[model samples]
Target: MISLKNITKKYGDKTVFHNFNLDIEENEITVILGESGSGKTTLLNMIARLTDFSGEISGAGQVSMVFQRDRLVPHLTVRENILLINENADVKRMLESVGLSKAENLYPKELSAGMARRVAIIRAFSHPAPLLLMDEPLVNLDLSLKFSLLEKIKELQSTTGKTVIMVSHDVKEAAYFSGRIIVLKSGGEVILDKKRVSEKTLTETLLNGQSI
Candidate 1:
């Protein structure tokens, strides 16, 4: 489990998190919900040790992240992209799980936005880590593709059960995918944190969606 206690960060005088605390259990998908500039990404970065912060985050293991940007080399094929991250024996299986089997030889230039995003997802998952962090994993995709990617992500999580944390603006997506949801305000304060209801409960909320 990842335990964050009294976590706080500041850039000069501006504060990010103030006395924030959370206990992310093992093998659970924690989704963060908030508007733009709510420091959700900052929080994820902190957890990944990619950003400087003044706090105590207690966890000892490898961590990998699927960045907000696809971050793929435009000239590299899908297989090459995942290989670039880690040249382990698990690379082929990872790509297959994310549904990029047929596009194995296609370069980033040839894939659509959703397809590119899936490549990034497999890249992160390819890393040998106990914790996985993803930011807006399904950023620019049509609705049909988005849900398909979501299911693939779910399958990947189930296979390894690596502690997963993803940040997204869509509450419906969070509610549908995550086992627990943590809502954050623009001020970096956590507004709500609750376990997501089952699919039947989520269907009721998603179908009657209002403005986020």
Candidate 2:
């Protein structure tokens, strides 16, 4: 499990989280949901140890992250990028799983947006990390691609048993992927924290601006 105690993050004069706390269980998916600029990404960065904050976090193992952007190497082929992280990674298998078998030899510049995102996810999973952090990875994808990628993610998580912490504004995505849902208000206050409920209930909570 991962624990965050008294997490306080600030940017100059503006504060994001003050004495915020959370606990994430191992081998489970936790979704942090909030609107843009609500400090959702900041919270993930803190857990990933990618950002500095005044807090104590424990039980986090090695982490692999997928950002909002694909962030693939423009000069490297899709397989090459995955190999860069894990030399013995099953690049072909991963590509095939995401229906990108033919994209193994293609560079990022030659791949579609959804394809690039798949490569990014595959690269992150290829690493030997026990924890995976995702920052709104499905943001701009079409609905079909979004559901497809979500299935891929579910498969990867179940196969690897990696602990996942994802931040997103999409309630349906949250309902579908998360075992636990944490809704944050602006300035990083957790307005709702509960076990997975129906998508309709989650949507109603968001629309009603209610906290639980």
**Alpha carbon lDDT at 31, candidate 2:** 89
lDDT of 2 by residue, 29-73 (tens): 888888887899998888888899998999986789999888888
lDDT of 1: 0.80
TM-score against truth, every candidate: 0.87, 0.96
Model 2 lDDT at residue 71: 85
- Model 2 misplaced regions, further than 4 Å: none
Clashing pairs in model 2, backbone N/Cα/C closer than 3 A: none
CA deviation > 4 Å runs, candidate 1: 197-212
- Please report how far candidate 1 places residue 105 from its true position, in Å: 2.4
Error of 1 at 27 (Å): 0.6
